[model samples]
Target: MNSRFDPSPAAVPPRGQLLLVSICLALYLLFCLQQIVLPFRFFGMTLSLGSVTMLGCMLAISAGSLVRHGVPSELVRPLLAILMCIAALSASVLASNHIGLACAFAVRYATSLLALWAMLSLAAACPRWPRAATLAALIAVWFNLALAGAVWFQWPGALRVALAFHPEETFKYLPRISGMYEHPALLATSAAMVLLLVLRLQQRGEVGRISLALALVGAVLALALTQVRNTLLPVGVLMAWWAWPRSCTSNRQRHIARVALGGIAVLAVFVLWLRYPDMTSAAQENMMTAFTLGRTYLWSGALDAWREHPWFGLGAGVFQFMVPDYTGGRFHRGELHAHNLLLAALSETGLFGLLAGLALIFALWRPLLRIAAERQWAIAWLILVLGLSTFDFYFPFFPFSMHAALAVASLHAGHCAPSQADGVSRSTT
Candidate 1:
């Protein structure tokens, strides 16, 4: 196959394809900038320019794909259907408690679904566009890493501008960095996803290998600087998974080696723990304190809500309203994401929502398993990120979830065209 850059004129992507590329790029920009383009009120509903842009592009691409392709793949329809069901179910369940919050949750969920469908359509409709999307992701990673480096080192010019952009939240975890995201974790999530994407692109021969290798290193460093423990899990898993095959012989051998490596890592930590017992104790205590953050009480409350609304959840986005009652108003100050996707789903949408969430996860991961192991790493990366969501939530947010779904969709697209020789294919089995 011709390189992504050397496509012939006829191979040039259509305007709608270009729009897809633009949407991917704009999402990254919006996530990093942390500033909504505009804000307004309509019939007592608040809206933003960023939201309008996202929705408009998604609608345009979805409509375009429908006309051009006569409905998206069977896979896309089910995924969208599942998402819509979850959102609608949640909104309907919670409408009575607070219509405004329910509407907000519904809107967020809808945007997420739109983004998913848009990315999937873009990838499926224009084979050329994934390369561009991957490239855009790489560019965003590079820019963010630079900005994060500046913030990490306290560069005066960067700090001044970054602070001016979102003083209250950006770099709030100072000495740590957010890199234009509202928090360090969000930045880490974005970088980690992009790193996996670059790696996938490199494997596919879509991007230069050396440049992406460097970008991967840069992304890893930036992720570390963010100091987000949960996000680190996925990235760490990705690195180890990538490195595992390089050092081992056969499948069985690799499995044994991975276990051995994990054992060694655990033992090393144990030794360090013994060597610095007091420090270890203090660190453990602090971690536990931070991790709890009234999560126990909150989780218990969620369980109570789940029991009461056994079939459906208390309604999507109702957890925030119920938290006050659960914790006696102790932990109601911060965001109400539940810090765990499962718990949030259970509390917000009950058993049905949880099942739908699981199905969605299955849809994302199942296809990758049928492909080669090296290709499987992309989905592995996603699985780890989703696993991390069990400890901390980000995927529910539109940009984060959209990027994730895109990665999954790209993998599925790649799987469907396994004959195409790309960078990873040559390098892998």
Candidate 2:
């Protein structure tokens, strides 16, 4: 019984719960992007209810805990703002051009945001959780990578057997990766994220580092082989953060590595784009097209939406609805989501909403800034670049935004770890 616990000033979590949530949020968005392309038939419904349930459970548990334990801080303001934003979203749907679809979107958004809020709050406040959270994320990535490998290796034969029953398609067929996901790019994206997180954990000397490292290397190799350019940014972002945490690792060497890696990344991207001319086309673009970062069409649509409604904007998930009505003939036939985060906000929530949302990031990020000032470089790097990778709608449908927000929040919450006796040193999940 050597383990002693205290919640006094000497042992408390500082409230950086949002940090873990942010990274998870990034993974969550990556997950959502993949989920959008499924054409499956489940009881005549193609949509995945699994995602809906997951987010719902997150929100429910968080809300339940909050009710049971209670919290007193300015943090509650953001939660209230999120709730109000959701309410405003409901109002927008009530006035939406397509009430039915908008309502569906609203349900999706509300549940996601609520879950995100709870997860971030809880992650920060919980005394014994950082390792558990890290483990949970690792498990998700590992599972996805395993599934992708199985699908990639088996797709050709599986397709042939399935095609024998319905050989009446004009579309060309190819055996590609699909992991546990509906699409190959998403699978690759998942692998890429897992690879980075695993590497970080390994670097930090977490358990299973070597095995996970080997697995991570394989995943990264496969991810690159898949050639999804959209997949590159997150991986690239993580690497930069991994290697670029202040002057901790000799600035001269770090600069050389950054330049070398940046140059190599650029060269690789150029080669892939050359091989696949029509980047957005499913067949023409190399598996590498998924990693490319030209999301102008979606961004413009978001801008047009913002121009129309700058105050409360189109109301959360209503951006998808606004996509068709606002921007015309510029993008793909049925594409939703602005590829860029800034553009998505400008289009969906407008100036005010975007500011409110970003303000949350800054508020949470400020503590990390202080940590960085004290030379806590890796953590700071994570914060600055988290939002740089993808455009996360404040929409509940996109889990990444909340993940990012919550992770940052958790880290900040953890700063007051004195209340838990020795805080970080004594904490476990």
TM-score of each: 0.76, 0.66
Q: In candidate 2, what are the lDDT values of residues 143-213, reduced to their tens digit?
A: 54554455446655644432221222301213344434443454554454444444444444443534355
Task: List ranges where model 2 is wrong by over 4 Å.
Answer: 1-48, 72-74, 77-81, 84-88, 155-176, 182-185, 211-215, 234-246, 250-275, 279-294, 321-327, 330-333, 372-413, 416-429
lDDT of candidate 2 at residue 247, scale 0 to 100: 48
Clashing pairs in 1: 203-423, 203-424, 204-422, 204-423, 204-424, 205-423, 313-349
Give me the overall lDDT of model 2: 0.50
Candidate 1: residue 153 Cα off by (Å): 5.7
